[model samples]
Target: MAAALELFGARDPDDISIDDVAAAAGASRALVYHYFSGKRELYVAALRSAAAGLERRPPPAGGAGSLDALAGALARYFDFAEEHAAGFTALLRGGGAGRCGEVGKIVEGVRGELFASLTRRLPVREPGALLRVTLGSWIAIVESAALDWLEHRDVERRALERLLVDQMVATLTAAARHDPEASHVLHNLKNDR
Candidate 1:
């Protein structure tokens, strides 16, 4: 499972064979087959393993207004993306893991967990519709930025991390202008800061 998880995250799932996993694990192909019926099953299991790693990460701890905590969270996210570059691409591209039903669910579960993680860091106990939308949009932005960063590799990681943090603050500031719920949260966040 560890071998498959590493390979799947670094290379295209289609390119990986049972033999490759066996070789990487120093086990026989027969042993691999003993655990998994086929390559797809193994791939799904590897993806599930990958998802669990991300899901298990503790939410960043600090005050709601702590931009430093947000930056720390972004740093960890980028570390994961960097470690799983090709796998992260495949998971988000809708051409690899997204093609499989189980794979899609795994990916969505990761996104949902990330969303919940962000919400927990905010001042709001329960977010209103507009704040919810704002948070959702911010997640999309972060994902898109990570994808672009992986493909281009032009922006420094620290710069990109700071940029994402600023983007979230700007988004919340904008949302607060028109939303009482957002306004309240923003006010609290600023006070804590």
Candidate 2:
């Protein structure tokens, strides 16, 4: 799986073959075939592996302010992003295997899980449309920033993490003005700190 991820990361999945994965893993082609019926199966398994690794890390400990928790989560996020650079870029940019049937589901599942995890940490009883849209936008921003950071490497990781967390606060703060629920959530965040 690691071999497949490395191969997929460096090049498009369509360009990689069973032989490539076998050679990278130092195993015979037959062995690779024995485990995976074909290239697509192996590719999906490798992507599932990557997704699992990213989700394995626990969110920041309880009682940490929402902002602190967000910072911690973003740090772990960037760690995975850095480790999987090309694969991460390919996944978020909707290129390569990510567009395939199973692959697309996996990507959407990851995004949904991430959205749920972050919002569950908030004090809101239920997230209304305004807050939902606000958080969704924040997630998009993080993905875009990660892609840009991978391509340019101009911003330091820590600075970028801080910037993202600030963006979240700024976004929430703005939403609070028009949304009472959002206002309550923002008030809790301030008090939590």
- Highest TM-score model number: 2
Tens digit of per-residue lDDT, candidate 1, span 8-89: 7667677888999999999999999999999889888877776776676666666655777788788888887887675566
Per-residue error (Å), model 1, residue 6? 4.0
C-alpha lDDT of all candidate models, in order: 0.80, 0.82
- Count clashing residue pairs per candidate: 0, 0
Candidate 2 local distance difference test against the native: 0.82
The residue pairs found clashing in candidate 1 are: none
C-alpha positional error of residue 74 in candidate 1 after TM-score superposition, expressed in Å: 1.3
Best by lDDT: 2
What tens digits encode model 2's per-residue C-alpha lDDT throughout 1-193? 8778878877878788899999999999999999999988888888777788788877776465466777888998999999987567656654475347887887887799888887778876568999999989999999889989998999999999999988988998999899988888778877775
